[model samples]
Target: MHPIALAILLTPLGLLLRLYAILPQGKPTKRGVRLVSEPCKLGMFLGSGGHTTEALTLLSSLDFARYSPRTYIVSCGDTLSAKKAVALESLKASEILAYSVITIPRARRVHQSLLTTPLTSMQSLATCVYHITLSPLITGVHFADVLLLNGPGTCVIVCIAVYINRFLGLHSPKLVYVESFARVRRLSLSGKILRFFVDRFVVQWPELAAADSKAEYRGWLV
Candidate 1:
C-alpha cells in the first residue's frame, strides 16, 4: 500500500491507542473526595452555524451557579461565536460570573483547498493540544467539571485533550456531547466518533436515539 493509504488506515487505530493509554483502569475507588462537592468549572466548544445557537440554548437551561468560571472555545476566525459568547457574558454580568473566550485554528475550514487539508489538520491538532493541556494556566481554573460539546470537528481534539489530562491523573472532566438538532436521522461524524468516549451522549431526535443505543433522546435543544 502507498504510504498515504497506510497512514490513513492507521490513524484511527493510533487515536484509539492514545485514548486507551490515558483512560483510568480497574474499578472506581469507594473512598476519596467527591467531584460533585466541589465548585464546577465549565468548558464549552462553540461551533459555527447552527451549532453555536444550539449550544447556547442548552446552556441557558442550566444553573449558572453550579458552573462558574466558564471558558468558551471557538475556531479561529469564528467571529460569530465570539460575539455570541460576549453577549452571554453580558447577561451574566449581574451575577458576577467569570468568562473567557479562546480561539484555536479549525481542524478544516469550509471550502478549504483540498491540497492543504492535511497541513491545516496538523496545525489545528497542535493548537487543540496546546489549549487543552494548558487550560488551567491560561483560564485560571483546573480542568472543567463538565466539557460540553455539540458538533464540529474541533470538539474531537478538545475531547482527546481532556481524556489525556484524565489519564495523567491531572483532571477528570465529564464530557457531555449533544447531537445537533439538524441530525434527526443519524449522528454526525463528530457525534459518531465521540459516542464511545463522552460521558453523556444525547440526541435531539427520537429516531436517532432508537438507532443508537449509546445515545439518549432528550428532546429538541433548538
Candidate 2:
C-alpha cells in the first residue's frame, strides 16, 4: 500500500484500539468526580416509547439548576419526545434552565431490511458527527459534560461519535448507560453492547450488578 493510504487505514485502526484500551473496566472512578459548584452541560438520548418514558423518569429527579443547558438528542419525526423534553423544562419553571433539542436520523426503522440497515445507520452516524461537533458552536451551548443513554440503537451511534471526538483529542462527555427498569435478570441488547463503552453502566437489579462486575446497582430510578 502507498504510504498515505496505509497511514489513513492505520490511523483509524489505532484510534479504535486506543478507545478499547482506555475503556472502563471493573469499576469506574475518575470520570464522575467533579466539583459540585461547577455547572454541567447534560446530554440525553431519548429513545421512543418506553425508552423515552424511562429516560424522562430518570431526568425528573435531577436538579435542573445543576444540569443546566441540557441537550436532548432525539430521532427525527419523534415529536412526542421533543415535546416531553420541553414540558419537562416547563415543569421546572426556572428561568435559569436552558436546553436544546437536536433531531438526528434514526439508526434504523421498524422492520427495516437488513441490507439497507447499514446504509441508514451510516447516515445516522454522519448526522451524529455533525451534531456532536458543531451543535455547541451553533447553539452556544458547551459540549455535554455527561451524556446519558438507555437501550436505544441510536445511542450506539452517539457513543461512536463521542469516541471519535475523543480520538481527535477534543473535549468529550463522560458516557453513562442506564439499563431499563424492566430489565431484571438479563441485560438488554443495547445495554450489553454499551457495557464496555460507557463510563458508567448502571443496572436496577442486584442480580445484574452481581453478574456483571462493571455494573452498578443503584436501586430503581423509575
Q: Using lDDT as the measure, which candidate wins? A: 2
lDDT of 2 by residue, 9-36 (tens): 9999997788766666665547556688
**TM-scores of all candidate predictions against the true structure:** 0.80, 0.89
- Candidate 2 worst ten-residue window by lDDT: 25-34
Per-residue lDDT of model 1, residues 2-118, tens digit only? 999999999999877876865433332134464765667888999988899889888877667667878898999999998998887777553675777888888778898989977
Computed on alpha carbons, the lDDT of every model, listed in order, comes to 0.79, 0.87
lDDT at residue 20 of model 1 (Cα atoms): 81
Local error of candidate 2 at residue 99 (angstroms): 0.8
Which numbered prediction scores highest in TM-score against the true structure? 2
Error of 2 at 42 (Å): 0.2
